[model samples]
Every structure is written in C-alpha cells, then in structure tokens.
Target: MIQKGSTLPEADFSQLKNGEMTNPKTNDLFGGKRVLLFAVPGAFTPTCSHAHLPGYVALADKIKAKGIDSIVCLAVNDAFVMDAWGKAHNADAIEMIGDGSAEFTKAIGLDMDTSVFGGIRSLRYAMIVNDCRVEMLNIEDPGRFEVSDAETMLKAL
Candidate 1:
C-alpha cells in the first residue's frame, strides 16, 4: 500500500473534460498542485453515485478554500462512463478521471479483485496530495465508506 509521504507513481489517465477528451499524466495533475483525489471501485456505482461524488461536489468550494487546487474523482471505468457519471451529478467542480486499465490503482497497491462484480477495481480511498507527494491517505476497508467521504476529509483539512 502507498503510504503518506510517498510520491504518486507515473501513470496516464483519460478524462472527458469540457466535452473534449484529454490525457493527463500524473505530474500534469499533481506535480505542483494540492489535489484532493478520491477513488471509487467503479463509476456510477450505488454508493459512489449517491454519496461519494456528491459529497465532494457539494463541498468543493470549501475544500478548495482549504488550499486544494483540484478535486478529482477517479474510477476504474472508461472515460465515457466517468464523464457521463460526472454530468449526471452536475459535478462541474470535480474532475472525473478514468483509470480504465487499473494501472494507477495497482501502482498504489489499492487494487482489488471483485470476481464477477468486476474483474479488478479500486478500493474506496481519498488522499491529499501536495506537489506529487501524499500528505494524507484514507483507504476504506472492503465494502466500507467510513474514512473516505468528503465531510471527513473536510474536517481533516
């Protein structure tokens, strides 16, 4: 598992931003910015759609006021699904990035095997990254959403 103080690994992510496809590398997103990044097992999953992403969307202004440069919602789904999910939630304040191949998830050691639910997915997690180095990491246990919600992260900030 990646620990606080570890720099994020290099990876490419696909995102549909402003109705255009964009490919951003790890450094492009985190190299010189304070980023609030949260990951879901899949895009549009029940809890994720109902709570996780919405929490961030609702609190995005406050979070950015706390010095966060960007609020990113990551998932192990394709860019198209992630974009649609973000649109559905009206998450204009959040950047929904897709890790379709789970490369970034596995690199952080947070990947899980979900069998029929999905071949591979990320465990629910939230982290504060500053200039590519992790400052805080909250990784949820299986089927749990305790530590990684936006309210908790806001309080932590």
Candidate 2:
C-alpha cells in the first residue's frame, strides 16, 4: 500500500464536469496542491453512500479551510455513476473522481478483490496529499470504518 512521504503514481482519472467528461492526469489533480482525498469501495454502497461520502461532503468547507486546495471522493465506479452519486448527495464542493478500471487503486496497492460482491474495488481510506506527496494516510480495516472518516481526518488536521 502507499505510505506517508511517498509521491502518488502517475495515472489517469475521469470526472464529470459541466455535463461533460473530463480526463485528468494525476498531476492535474495533485501537483502543487494540498488535497484531501478519500476513497470508497464502490459508489452508492451502504456505508459509502450513507456515511463516508456524506461526511466529507458535510465537512468539505472546514477541511478546505485548513489549507486543502480541494477535496476529492474516489470510487471504482464509472464517471457517470460517480457524477450521479455526487449530485444525489448535493456534493457540489467535492470532486467526484472515477477510477473505472481500478487503475489508480491498483497503482497505489489499495485494490482488493471481493469476488462475487464487486470484483475489484478500492479499500476505504483517506489521505492528505501535498504537491503529489502523501502527508498522512488513514486506511480502514476490512469491513470496518473508523480511522478514515471525515471527523477523524478533520481532527488530525
């Protein structure tokens, strides 16, 4: 898995912006910026939709107040689903990032195979990245959601 002080790997991601699909490279999102990034196993899952993404959406303003240039929510779903999920939650302040093929998740060593459940998906986690380097990492245990929540990350900041 990725660790503190390690720079993010090069990868491509997609997001829905202005009703259009935008392809963004890693540098475009993380370079020269302090970003609060959190990942969910999949979009619209029980915990993710009810808690994880909502927490970040609620706390986004406060998180950005602490010098974070942007707040991002990542999932293994396609950009269309991600965009719809964001809209469902009214997450206008958060960037809904889609890693459709688990490319970025695998590169960071956070991908997990859930077999019949969902195939390949990212583990739930949150991190603080500054200029492409990880400043802090909070990864959750399997079937658990503790350290990676928005409140914990807010307190840490």
Show pairs that collide, candidate 2: none
- Stretches > 4 Å off in candidate 1: none
Model 1 accuracy (lDDT, Cα): 0.94
lDDT scores in order: 0.94, 0.95
Instruction: Give the Cα error of residue 104 in candidate 1, in Å.
Output: 0.5
Which pairs of residues collide in model 1? Answer: none
Q: How does candidate 2 fare on TM-score?
A: 0.98
Q: Report the lDDT tens digits of candidate 1 across residue range 78-150.
A: 8899999999999999989999999999999999999887889999999999999999999999989999999
